[model samples]
Structure formats: C-alpha cells, structure tokens
Target chain A: MKEFQYKNPTRATWAEDYSFLNNDLDNSKLEGDKNKKSNLKVTDLNLYIHQHHILKNVSLEIPDNKITCIIGPSGCGKSTLLKTFNRLIDDTEGIRYDGSIWVDDVDIFDKKTEITDIRKKMGLLSQRPCPLPMSIYDNITFGCKLHGIRNKKRLAEIVEEQLKAVGLWEEVKDRLHAPASKLSIGQQQRLCLARGLAVEPEFILADEATSALDPISSKHIEELFVELKKDYAIILVTHTLRQALRIADHVIFMYLGKVIEAGPADEIFNNPKEELTRKYLEGAFS
Target chain B: MNRILKNKIAAGMMFSLTLASISLVVLIGMGLYLKSAPIFKEHSLWELISSADWQPSSGKFGFLPFIGGTLWITGIAVILALPVALLTSIFLSEHSKPYVKKWIFPALDILAGIPSVVYGVWGILLVVPWVSEVLAPHFVEYATGYSTLSGGIVLGVMILPLLISLFVEIFAAVPRDLRDAALSLGATRWQTSKLVILRKTLPGLLAAVMLAISRAFGETIAVLMVCGNIPLLPHSLFDSCYPLPALIANNYGEMLSVPMYESALMLAAFFLFIVVLIFNTSSRAVIYKLERKFQ
Candidate 1:
C-alpha cells in the first residue's frame, strides 16, 4: 500500500519529536491542543451485549474539523463505537452501556436528551448505501422536509448543493426525478452521501461506507470525505488499513475492543508505539 | 428403469392436477353462458340490463336494480374497512409490543377462520337490531331493521381480518434497511412510515384492498341475512337492496319452478364472476408492476 504524504510540514517535526517516546505515551498529551473544543469526547465507554463485553473502557477525543478513522479487525467493536455517535445502537435489545459520549459538549446519553435532536446533529452512512425507495430528488430532500424546509426554492437549492458536494450533480442532473434504485451501486453510495449531507449535520459517521464499492468509487468517496472534513467532523470505521492510511487525519487502533493506540495519522502509521498496532499494521493479522 | 417410471408417474400427476384446475374454470364459464343464453335470446340484452322491473311471472328480467345494489354495498363496505384495517396493520407491525402482537395475531387468525355463516347470524342478532334501534330513527324517517347499510357494515367486519393480515404482511416485508436509512436522517416514526414504507408497499396494499373487495363482492349467506334481499335500487343507506350474491343464493331454488328464472339467476352469477375476475386481474397486474419496479 502506498503511504500518503503529509500536507503540513510541521506535522513531520511533531512526528520526529514523538518518535523516541516509550510505548506508554500519555494519551491526553498526544491528542494535541486540549484547550480546543473536541468534536466528540468519550470518557470511559464500556459496552456489553448479554454479559459479553463488546467494548471495554474505551476513551478517546476526536478533534474538530478532521477525519478520524477507527481501524480494527472484525468484531473489534469499531462499528459499535461509530453507532454510539448517533445513538443508533439504542434500538438493539440486550445491550447495555456505561459511561457517556459528548458531541459538541452535550452528553448524548443524558436523561433529558432527545434522541431525535442528537441524531439530527449527525449523519450516518452504512456499509452499503441504503437509499429510500424514491426519486433522486426526493431522496436528497427527505431530510430537509423532515426539518421543516418546505419552501420549493430552498429545497431545490439544497438538492443541487448536496449533490454537487458529492460530485453527483453532473451525472444525474438530467434525471433528478428518476428512482434512486435505478442508479449504479457506486452512484447510489454517492447519492446516500448527498442525502446525508442534505441535513447539514455538524458531524458525519461513516461505517465502512466504501467497502461495497469498486476501487474507483472508493477513491471518489475518500476524496469527498477529505473535502468534507474542512467543514464537518467525520468519523469513519474501516477494517482496511490502506483506507485508514490513505484518508485519515487521525487514526485510532483497537484490538479486542480496547483502544491500543491513537494519535496523528502519520505517527500512528509510521511509528506505532504499541506492539499490537505495529503487528496489525505490518499485515500480520487484520 | 424404476426411477424413470417414478418420474413419469410424478410428471403425469402434476399435469393432471393443472388440467383439473383449468377445466373447473372452463366448465363453470361454459355452464353459465349456456344457461343464460335463452334469456339473452328472448329479450334484448339491453332490456334485461336497463329495465328496472324484475317480475319473474310476467317475464320482466331487468338486472339494473340488483347491479346498483351490489355496487352500493361493495363500495360502502370498502370505504368503511380500508382505514380501520390500515391503522390496525400499522399498529401490529410497527407500534405494538411483542406481547401485544402475540395476543392480537392469534385472535385475528381465529377471526379469519370463523365461518361466514356465523358472521351472518351475528349480524342478524346484533348489528341489525343495533342499527334499527340506535341509528335508524335519528338518521332517517323510514329506516328498516334490514337495510343496505347493515349489510355493508357486516361485510366490512367480515373482511377486516383478511385485509389486516395482508397489510401486516406487506408492512413487515418492507426492508429494515430502508426504515433505518430514513430514521437515521432524523425522521419521526410516522414520517418514515408515510414517506418510505408506504410508498414502497403501495402496490401490495392496493392488491390487498382489491382482494378484500373481491371477497366482499362474492359474499353470500351473510349478505343475504342482512341485505333484506329486496330486488330494488337502494335510494338511501336505510333502504333495503339486493346484491348479486344474495339474489342468486336466495332465488336459485326458485329456478326449478319458474320459466327463465334459472337463466336470470345464471346471468347474475356470470356478472359476479366477471367483476371478480377484473378485480383479481388488476391486483395481479399491480403486483407485477411492483416487482418490475424493484428489479
């Protein structure tokens, strides 16, 4: 796999400074700029399903305006961690969680917190694009309508802006009224991204959003995520190390449902402090 | 050699089964056409269809009154049943808890399995009297204890189980991923149902309603017990009327004594068959379109 060159020259100096650190680096210091508001803060999140611990004492801080990729092998609770951002895990039976996740300084699990409001602040993309069975225009406008955007001109502008953001406007501009199911799988994923962005969410949670797509489509979606990270905080869960390396601004490594290592993407990829992170990144076991 | 003989026997049996079902429909259609031919030959088809008088002894065999009555009863019954069945199905598939579904499903299955005759008796004992004593005098001056409205309400109740079950199946068949996609976008449950689930399952819902309408059209004993079997056009909900099923079921025996009575009865049966055939065919077309759309 090809390594992505860092865009910022200062990041190289920071990586060099952290290169000689022992395996047990202080996690808070490595997170960078503690005074800045974290996009998402997890204090100590422990999740269990029917007495089986799925995630144990996981703590991390996702910086604002960056793509934070959570990478782990199968069944490592990567997807579970992403779902907690939007509270999508609340629907599952026999699941219990201790600790809190705060998004934009608001604890999502607060007793008085409204789930719909929390969900509104985030957009979620699944492994496979699941578009509502409707026209392309309607798919883009569905979230807007739910948020009470009823003006025709505003909806049309939103549709154009969202589709343009995901680079789908030129391809599907002529047939906005066509059924969304008529699109190719790659086009469908882009359309789903457009649909998610239509809500103007402050955060985006993508759970393996490109695994089902072809290589070209995967690249297109990765580029879109990189572009989107400037305005919204994006958290992606991927098992593909190459994908995490290609687009992640920060990388979180998990093993057996524990955060083994987490830091700037270049440092985590070039000089991983934990033995598990090194072995897993060296293609020993995925 | 033994296996070949067994396969041959199996193929022959399957072919015979298919042939038997097709021949049954052919036989009924032929019988209806042949028996009703004399009526059409004696009086012009238009006269029998357009004339209001239906006296058997004097040989007037107009079917206009019965046709009007059939339409009125079936239309009213569908209008009464559709909203109730849809709401019940939505609750069963989406809102109801597991324990609630456990109790409701078996109750509905039992209601569906109950004989239509029991519904007839129940309507006569309960619905008919209630309409007359509670609803009639206040609504109309000359309301009868047995009227078109009573028959419609009875047929509506009788078909509720069929409609509700079909709708439940349709609603449940909507892919879970679609619902998740909508809800994850911050849509309320009602919005998800209306915008996503309802649009996806529309064809199946239409098919269900058409099937229920076909059932209501062919309902016999229950409709007869409550419909008053009056061979006249119903001017109001409180007026007595006769649908085709009740007309045939009530008067088929009289064909043995009266001239041209059997022919008239056979014609009514033929009309009922045609109406049901149209409904079933359209329902099938809708389902086919739905499948093609998905593909």
Candidate 2:
C-alpha cells in the first residue's frame, strides 16, 4: 500500500511511469533520444556451439522501460540470444561467445563480472514452468532466503507481494503451503513468474513463458507483461507474431540466426524495410 | 484360435510362477516357526528376548545380549558410513571430473563385488590389529584384541560401496530442469544440491540407507571375526560382544548335541528375518509414497 523507490539508480524503478505510452506512435521521435541510457547494449555478439556458429555478428540496444520481443522461427537463435542476457547458456558445454553484453553499464561477459550478481539483476522464465520441488510459499522465498532474508514476517510479506504482482495471490491465497507441483500448468507458470520476481530483478527475460499455457492464461500473462514493462524492461522470445503484435512495443525479427530487421512495432508492421521481414510477418513461413 | 490359446498358456504360466515364489517364502517361514515353536512353548517370548543370561547348562536361554550387540554394532556402522557415503555420492554425481568418474566408478563396482569372507580376512589382518594395538590402548582401559568397535568399523567399510552407488544413482536421476531453475535464481551449486536436489530425492536416499542397514544387520563372517563373540552385554565400544548372526554361525554345528539350543538358535534366525522384513517393507513404502506424490 506504500510507494517504494529503488535506492540505486541502476536498479529497475518500481513506480509505473507511463510517459513512454504517449511517444509510442512516432518511431523517429523515440529514436532521436539515443543519448539516453538503454537498459541493455549488445555489441558485435557472436555465439558458437561446439565450433558451429549459432548467432552471427549482432548488435542491438534495448530501450529502458519497454517490451522488446525477439520474434523468429525455430532454431533461429532467439532463445540463445535471450539466454545470453542472464548467462544461462554458459551451462552448456563447449559454448563460446565472442561479444559484450552490457547491463546497467556493466559488461556481463567480462571475466571479472560476478555471475550471481548479474543473474540477480534479471529474472528468467523458461519455456515450461520448472518450480523448485517445494511448497508454493517456499518457492517464492527461495531466492530471498538465499540472499539472506531471515525474518519470517518479512518473508511472508515478500511472498504475498510477489504472488500478487503476478496475479497468483487471489487464486492461491489459501493454499500457500501446498506443493508447487500440484498446481495446474497455468498456475505453475504464474508461480514461476512470482518466484522470479521475488528477487526484485531489474529485467525479466522470458523464453516462451506462455507457450505451454492455455489461451486464457497466456492472455493474463501478456497483460501482466504489458503492465510490468512500465517498471522493468521486458525482453521476450516468442514465435507467435500475434502475441508479439499484441504486447511488443519494439520488435526484432531474426532469421537464420541473424537479425533481419528491428524497429518500432508499428513501423516494422506497416512499412517493411527487408523482404525477409515482410514475408515472415505475412505468414509465408514460420 | 491359436493366438488365443498361446495367450492363455502364457498367462497361466506367469500366474503359476508367481504362486511358486510366494509359496516358497511361506514354506521357509513355516519351517522356521515350527523349529522354534518348542523354545517359545518352554519359555515366555518376553523372557527369551529380555533376559540377559545365556547359561545353557542351567537351561537359561536369554537373547537380550545378542540383540543388543547387533543393534550397537549396526548403529555404529551406520553412523560411521552414512556421512562418508553421502559425500562420496555428491562428489560422484555433481563435482567429479569426467576422468575421475571414469576411474572411480569401476573401482567402486569392484569393491561392491568383493566377497564377505575376503572382507573378513582383510579385517582380521588389518582393522582388528589396528583397533587392538593403536585405538584400544589409547582410548580404552584393559581392552581386548577383538571388540564391537572393530567389527563395526569393518562392517561400515563393507557397506560403503553399496550406499555410495545407490546415492549416486538417486542424485543423478534428479531432473536437469529442476537444477537449472534453482541456478537461474542465482543459487550456488551447493545450495541447489542441498535445497532442491536433496529434498526431491529424500525418499530414495532413505530407501538406500534402509537397504544398507538391512545388509549390515545380516552380515555374518566379517562381523563374526572381529566382534569377539563374548555372549555378554558390551559395556563400551572396546568391549567384546556376540551379535545374533555370529552366535548362530558359531554354535549351529553343536545344535544336535544340546537340548533346546537348536530351537533357540532358530528363534534368533526368525527374529532376524522379521527385522529385515520390517526394514524392507518400510523402505518400499517410502518409495511408493514418493512416487504417488509426484504422480
């Protein structure tokens, strides 16, 4: 019920600022503010999986406080690109990336970067909901406990706040102590989102978070993401162009592991610059 | 018509096989019960189990000392072996390098395959002498060459390979996505293992430990050689004691010459079988509950 502000300027702002909504129509006006700090900057990114190049030389600046959807067909490196933001791809053996991804003015790929700290700054939702094998309350507070929040009242409040943020509190308010695996697939994904948000991440990196959910649940999640972008930058990887058009403020179309075209959603949809982008948007092939 | 006849034949054969195995166990249990019935008729069950005296000439057939000795030695072995096995399993499943796993796995398999008699010979040559010479003089006063401590140490070593293998398999069976989910939340590797993996596989771990305990309870030659078979309640770890299996192994040959001795020994065997049955059933129950929870 009280307003909360981030003490650190580099952290995502919790208060909703809707000024970006007014400038959504004009692509040139938004692009003119290039001097302003972006949430993330990728420079000459190239990813290789066991000597096979997966992503070609790619560079893009993700604007702050916006929903940027990376849309592409299967095996187009969209998920790989999304994973690189939180360094989840590092878990794969023989994965080599020659690029610099800067988040909050720090190079995440730098040798001196603390991976735990970098991951804490970004929340990740995988394709399927993989809740920790625990009670719902414990799932939400796992990251908080790892970060040294030991107070019971504080933990209970955090569970409520995060679950409410993802619209899971009302549905699961009475069964907070139930096992997370007992929930439906839709509820489990929402609980995963709540668990991710409990860490108070500045960015939400979702890889097909709604692909496994029903249409109603997917609609709820899409609406939640639209509201979330006002406080945190959301970078999503989705194969559905309809979902992208419904939620994405900025869109990047990738083909064969390369970014073909990227700009404001309206501009890319109305006036096509590249033939591949136009064909892909027109449903020639997915 | 031929296919239906074949199917009926196969079904009848499978049913008969199942019945044969169940009847075999029932027949063996009935034989043991009949052999031990004379002792139970002569003395009260409580007195046979709780009385401490074992004077055969005076016709006192107490079994408390053997039961106590078995429990003591098995408890010590479990305490000594469990932590080591858990650590070894965690290393093998999560932390081992590929080359290390390649060598250690076969070595562990070989250890598991070694005969109990070989372990008994090895313990007599090495572990018994070390306990008597080095440990007894320093830690205990007026201790003998054979002790519960020595036997427990040997049994602990014998069960380690089995426990480690079971634990490693359980840890390996944890789904990869569960671990990735934990790590993506910025948890350290140890935290993920302790908080997520361990919790998920707890029932399996318990089953493994129960299996090891059952094996230790029935272990014979290795325990016999080191336990010193004194047929008395041990006052300390350094004191000599006679476990139930050792008592049966040592005195079964003389059963025909003595009256009621054979029946008492049969009763001991029956008691041991019951204990093992309880352990196995509980372990299976835990696994069953775990599977049902997940489903």
Candidate 3:
C-alpha cells in the first residue's frame, strides 16, 4: 500500500484568497464572541416516533462560531437532536415533531418554510463518509451547481478552494475526474468534508464523523474542525469522551433524551453541575 | 472428531452436487450440437444462415428470414420497453410512497405470473385490431395487424414485468445516505435521482436489459400467434415475418414427412439455445462484476 500524505495548508494563505476564511480567531476571542449570540436556538422541542417520546422538551442554545460536542451514551437522542437541526430523519414513518428549531430567527418546521432552502445553511457529515457517486471534481461542484452557479471558471475555483481547505487538493489534483468512491476511506471522508464546505454553510453538523476513520485520519478531521470553528459553527455528535475533551470549546451533554449539562468544555468536564454529567464524564455508564 | 468427519462428508456431497449441476449445462449443449450435426454436414453454416431460399423440397434451408424477423421484433420490443420500464422503476422506487409501492409491486408480480398464451390471445383481440384499423392506414396501404409490429408490441408488454422488477431492485439498492448527501446539498428530488442514483446503477441496469432481451428472444407462443408466421424478410414493422421460435414450432410436427426439414428445425433450435445461453451467462457475469465493484 502507498503511504498517504497531504499538506495541512496554513489558514493565512487560505484567508488571503477566500472571503469566507477571513475570520481567524484564537480561543479567547472566540469565547468572547460566543457570549453575545447563539447561532441556533431550540425551544420546547419534542420529537416522537410511533407515540414513543424520543426527545422530551429538548431545548438548548448552540453557540455561534465554536465547536460544541454533543456527548452522551448511544440512543440518548444525541444523534436525533443533531438530525433535528437539519430535519434529516424527520421524514421517517410515524415520526412527529412538536417543536421549533430557529435558524436565523425563523422556525424551520413551519409549513411555509421550504425544507431545501433551510437545509442549505448547514452541511452534515454523517457517521460514515458518503461521497456522491461521481467524479471528485463533480462531487465538489454538485452542491454549487444545484444553487445555479454556472460559470465554468467559478466552479473550478470552488472545487480547488474546498479541496485545499480539507487538504485533499494536493492528493487528488491529478485525478480530478476520477470517481470519488475510489479514494481511500480516510481520503473519502476528507473529500466529503470538502464537498460539504463547497456549499458554503454557516454551520457544519457532524454525527460521529470520525468514528469510521483510522487514528491518523480522525486526528486529521479533528485538526480540520479546530481550524474551521473560526468561520463556521461546528456542532459534533460523539460518544467518545476523549474526542469531546480534545476539540470541544463548549459541550452539551444529553441523557435519556434530555439535556443534562451544557456549558464550556472545561466547565462540563472538570466541574459538572449535575451528578449524571459528572458520572457520565467519569465513565460511570457510557 | 466424529462430528468433523460428518461435516467433511456433508461438504464433499454438496460440492459434488454443485459440479453435477454445471455438468448438466454442458450435457445439454452437447445434446443440441449432436442433434443438429446432419444439417451442418448438408450445408455450410454461412450459406445456411445467409441465403434467402428456404425451400425444403429441393433440400434448401436458408435461415435469413427467421433471423431477420427475430432481430427486428426484438429491437422494436426493447426500444418500446426501455423508456417505460426506466420511468416506471424510478417512479416506484423514488417517488411513490410505501403504500403506493406496496400496491404497485404485487401487481407487477401478478403480471409476471400470467402465461404467455394469455398474452398472445389478448394481443390477437386488442393490439391486432388497434394496429390494423386505427394505425396502419396512415402510413401503409394495408396491414393485417398480424405482423412484426403486433409481435413486437406483445413481446414488449410481455417483458415489462421482468424489466420493471429488475430496475426497481437496482434503484432501491442505492443507500438512502447517498441520496440524502445530494438532497442536503439543496438538489431537488429529480436532480438527486439523475446525478446520483441513476448514474451509480448504470452497469446493473445494462445487465438487466440484457437479461430481458434474452427472455424476449426465446418467447415462442405469444410472438408466433401474432407474427403471421410467413418465412419472409420484414422490410417494415407492419410486414409479416417468421421468428426462429415460430419457425421451429410450426414446422417440427411436419418434419418427419420431409428429409432435410427435421435437421433444419433442429439447427434452428440449437442456434436459439446458444444465443439465449450466451446472453443469460454474460448478463449474470456483468451483474456479478458490478456487485463486486460496488461492495
């Protein structure tokens, strides 16, 4: 097997070229900025499937421009909440939502709201990387093309820009027209991230995005998220405590379909206000 | 140790049974070749197929009409079925609700279950009249409606259930996540289907079409009844012609009275079997290769 290597390009070089990458905030500046406004506001959100309560009155304020890891045991509705942000799994049979998720001060579940229009605001990285069944270049431009960006030169630039952001351009630059599925699993995940970013969303919702990747690859993704948080609100769903502690600036802990504790990463991990949060953090029940 | 011996015995028996099934196919091929040997000795294979004269009285047995008719009918049938099948499969798999699909799918299965003879009867009653009375007068001077066009229509309808079922399976096998990946990018339902799912399943779809074509080739009773079985070249869709299966069916019982007739019919049967066998095997191979590549 060939050894895989790609440069993690500096943000300074990226910032000079792209308007979106202009924000380069360190920890203190991001923390200062978050206290002013939450990017997403969920109010009295209750979800049910076949008359069984899945999320019970789930309400939280997800901070803007920060990495907020939703960590809890499996089936605790952490993933369900992440999906609720984009209304991804709401179309499943017998699924009913009795809540409002306000993105940009508009209720997303309103009958008048167009689902596709709102979904464009957030790019979701699912548990397993699913590159669209297309060439690598087409995969990046697919989302842009959907939004009606027809200029050939512009599409080419967006493809190169997104790929370089995720450190995939150097590796896949030669094989731009090759099928995206042909890449290594680690590389495919990066390609998917690049694809997600090309759509230019304000928030990136990842549901255990690195769970399917090897250590080096997961580390690669974590580093990408750290760099990306300056410009995009990065919301991650994870069961791994180590990962949550590693990259999360803020943490939202949920258990039994309820938010147990929500605050800064150290505040939740070090001095948890709730006993359940402390126990969960201490590996009481994963 | 005793259980291990029993397990080995069972494995050995299963393996031999598998080998037996393969040998059965070889046996059939050998049987077909041997039965058709007398015809090979009588005429050169090229002269046998390419020549127009098929008179049995003078020992002439050209197969051009039957071969041409089969090709024309099959070509027309596939052209008619491909778009309808693709659209129907897409509708059932992507657009229809579960309840709608639940209702539609069993109907297709029931369509598959009905005998070909029934389809032929229906074709004679409805399609023949429709083509003769309503369609042919505009283009041609006269048509009996018992022509290649009628056979093609009936054959296309007959192959519908199989094509739809295969296409539906192919479309449905694409993971929901891949669709969601496209949908989340703000792509509409049709765009997602066209760019993602349809493109991904092209190889399997090709395999399915090949399988349906083979099935269409060997369809005997339905095609024979409506085709106005005359051993002549079909210059147009409305012209009467005789397909290979129809040729074998109409001539086999009368073959004993004529010397070269039985050999000629056997040769037709042999050629049909070989063509169908090659198509079936190669289509299966394509589908298998596609499965391995995707996985």
Candidate 4:
C-alpha cells in the first residue's frame, strides 16, 4: 500500500531516501539529516501471520554502520520484524505482509528481486546455536563457496580472519578441522558468529544470539558486536533489557506490534517517553 | 516388617522376569549348539564346508551351494532395494506434504506388517510366472526355468517396505537445525538434503541397511517359493538356486531315509544359526560405535 523509489546521485554510490505521510502521525517530519545516511527505511509496515497482526503500521530508520537493538517482550513482533529485513519470512508458511521494505532504494518485495542477493547482503544469526555438521573451517568457508569464490588461499585467509574477528581463533585454531558439533556450547555460538561474518555482509541481524549462552559467553558476544559495528550495521532483537543497554547504540522499544518509543539507547533507558517503555525498563513486565 | 518384605519380593519377581526374557535366547542358543555337536562329529566340518554338491539321498551333504546361494540372493536383493528405498525415504522426509506423508507413512507401516507366507504366495503365483513367461525368453532364449533372478527380485520387493520405513524414521530423526543451517547459508533445498542432512545421518542409514540385509537373509518362505529349489550351483542368474533357509525348509520334513540325513539337516541348521548370530552381533557392535561417535 506504499510506493518506493531510488535516487542515484553518483554512478556507483546509491542511497534509499523514503518519505511517508499519514493522518495519524507525520513520519516525513522525522525524516531529518538522520535519514540521509539510512541504508533501509520501513514505512507503514504491517505483517499478518495466520490472521494475527504481528506488526502494526511500524516505521523506523536504520542508519548505516550502527547497531540498532530492538527490545520487547516475548511475542512482541521484534523477531518477526527482523525477519522482514531480508525477507526471511517468505519461507514461513501462511504468512503475509503489507509494507514497503527498501534497501539501497530498491523495494525488496519486487517480484524480479532474488532472495539470494538480499540474503548475501545480510547475515542472520538465530536465537539457538546452530553449527553445520562439518569442520569448523568448512563452516566459515560455506558462504564463500555459495558466492562462488573458489580460490583456496583466499578462502583460507578469510576463514582465519573471521575466526580471529569473533575471538575464537585462539581456542579453535588447533582444531579447525574438527567437527563444529564437537565444540562446547559457548565455543559453538562463537563459531556461528564467525560463520556469519565469513560472508562479509553489510548488515547483520542477530535474534537473541546470546539468550542460550552463559554470562561469560554473553559478554564475549557483546564485545564482538561492538567490534563488528565498525564495518557493518547490526540489528539485534533481544528480550533482555540489560543486553540492549550493554551493546546497542540505538534502541527501538516495541509493545504489541507498535513502536512505543525509539531513540538513542541512553535516552530510552534513562528517560523513557512512554509509560509501557518505562514499566518494561523497571522489570514490571517483560 | 511383613509388608516391606512383600514389596521387596514383588520387586525381585519383576526383576527376574526381565532377566529371564533376555536369557531365553541364550538358553535356546546353547541348546541348539549342543544338539548340533553329533551332526558336526559324524559329517566332519571339512566335508560340510568344502563340498559344493549336496544330495542327501546319496548320503553326501554339503552347505556351500546353500550358503553361497543365500549370500548371492541377499547381495542382489540389497543391490536392487537399497537405492530405491533410500530415495523414497528422502522424498518422504524432505519433499512430501504433511497430509501426504501421514497417509504414505502408514501405508509403509502396513507393508512391513504383511505376512511372509502371503509374500511367498505372491512370489510363486505372480512374480515367478511373470519373470519366466514375460522376461526370460527375450533374454535367455533357451530359458525354461524360474531363475534365481526371479527369486532375488521377489525377495527385494518383500524387503522394500522394511528398508524404506526404517530409512524414513532415521531421516526424520535428523535435526531440523542442521537443515536450516545449511539452507540459510544459501544452499538450495536439494543441496541441504544431500550434503548436510544425508551426510550427518549416514551412520544410521548404514545400520538400517545392515538390519535389512539380516532380515532378507533370514527370510525363508518367499525365497523358497520362487528360487526353483534346485541343488546345483547357479552359474547364472537364470539358473535355479537353493539357499540355506530354502534348504532347511525343503529337506527338514523329507529326511526319513537314512539317519545321516537328520545329521546333514542339523548341520545346515547350525550354519544358518551361525550366520544369523554373526550378523546380529555385528549390527549391535556397529550401532554401538555409531551411537558413541554421534553422541
């Protein structure tokens, strides 16, 4: 129910500049200097899964090279909204959406668009730890193979770099040829992080990646997110308010499928504008 | 004090029942081994193991042809059934819709429950006639016999449901996370099934295949009905065959002639027992190894 277009100012560099007008709230006014560096824009987004509205008229701007954390209660549509960024919900059965999700000025819902390119541009790490039934080395190179980079030396180097980037190379460097399932739970989660970064995606979506991990492992993943935000924009959906405060630069607080309040993490945590947001921060409700 | 002793007595009674249930097989095995000793002594293990020709009426009994026949039929049947059953399993596990799977899966379960005697009757009246009358003449020219090929084909069909159902169960037990991980990495659906799921499930698949092979070897009625029950070594698939189970079935009742006939038949029983015992032991060993490895 919305229109999307691209504006090309240079031959190689492109930007997605979106504007929306509504009688309920004028979103175009929120489109300030911040919107100029946005890689993706969500406007009037609505999602229905089996006749249950999961997201309702949501609009937000995801800036470049920043970690945007979505904090909400369980079943509050944070993960569902994350799935829309790369169209991961397309494979979900009996799901439908009425929204325009734009990436670099291209409407992702266009029939001519391929999911592989979108998936390649964005890496998603799910809540549960999943390592392939393969060697740790092969897990890192699986993305390279999918993208048809067959050079052996380059792949080896990339695997090493990504492993080192996630701070797992020291523990697993000696056992890189071992099956990833052989690693401990904390180690496997870090291996999955390295696997995600191996593809060199511009954006990373983590759906509560540290929920199943211990405190030390949780801190390690938060540190990795800090290091990774320098080169990639990361969108994290977490039910833990403390987790969001620890890692996020910007936080979007959603309750019942609508954005309750969103701002810089410091302001949202120290001085929440909405009552539900304040109650959620105080642990009155999840 | 009396009530506590009664409860302990009941617990001990149940424990003994569980122990006896497993010990029953060991008792039967020991009894069979002892009963086989006289036959082994009269027919000198060399004669039974070396000679290929078996004619009880002439007082010469050898187990080579029957053992060889069992191996040949099982080998051929596995060759025919394994690929088809595995492919069907893959389809059921990964491709079929939920409603279709619900229907098809129960149909396979029913196939596993079908009686072996019914399979025998079908092989004799249906498969043997079809092979001899329809296919043999075109290929062999002088073929007037129901061949080992017919028997093996019938046995293969009989074991198909068993192999397929076990394969489906194992394939379904593979973790969905493994499949999702592969698919999320940009591997196509088929690639995910082939490379990740199938590779991870290989040890279980191999165990299923071995169990199927043991079942096929121990099968008596179906192979006996269709194999033509000849006593000579089969040089070609077109020739009639006599396997160990078929020999046990065919000669056990007709050995009223000399007392040595009983000994010879008992010797064949021992051979069949040893083969089955070896298979069961090896299957358990391999499955144990796989369980430890995967865990």
Each model's total of backbone clashes: 0, 0, 0, 0
How large an RMSD does model 4 have?
A: 6.9
lDDT of 4 by residue, A1-286 (tens): 0221222111122112112211335454488764443377788899998789999999987756667899988988998899888886765656888878888677778788776677777777888888877789988998788888899999999988998898888998998888888998888888887887787777888989899999998889888888787778889999887778667777799999999987666667666788888878877223
The DockQ figures for the candidates are 0.54, 0.45, 0.46, 0.34
Cα lDDT of model 3 by residue, A90-207, tens digit: 5466788887899977799998988887778888898899998778999899999989999999999999999999999999999999888899999999998888889888889999
Give the range of the ten consecutive residues with the poorest summed lDDT in model 2 chain A: A1-10
C-alpha lDDT of candidate 4 relative to the true structure = 0.79
Candidate 3 lDDT score at position A184: 95
lDDT of 2: 0.86
DockQ of 4: 0.34
Q: For residue B31, what is the lDDT in candidate 3? A: 85
Top DockQ hit:
1
Candidate number that wins on DockQ, 1 or 4: 1
Off by over 4 Å in 1: A1-38, A46-53, A94-96, A255-258, A273-275, A284-286, B2-16, B289-295
Residue B248: error of model 4 in Å? 1.8
Q: Model 2 Cα RMSD, Å?
A: 6.8
Kindly report the TM-score of the first chain in candidate 3: 0.86
For residue A98, model 1's alpha carbon misses the true position, in angstroms, by 4.0
Q: Which stretches of candidate 2 lie over 4 Å from their true place?
A: A1-38, A284-286, B287-295
TM-score of each: 0.89, 0.88, 0.89, 0.85
Question: Please, what are the lDDT tens digits per residue for candidate 1 over residues A79-146?
Answer: 98888878778756567999999887789889888877778878888999998888899999999999
For model 3 chain A, give the 10-residue run with minimal summed lDDT. A1-10
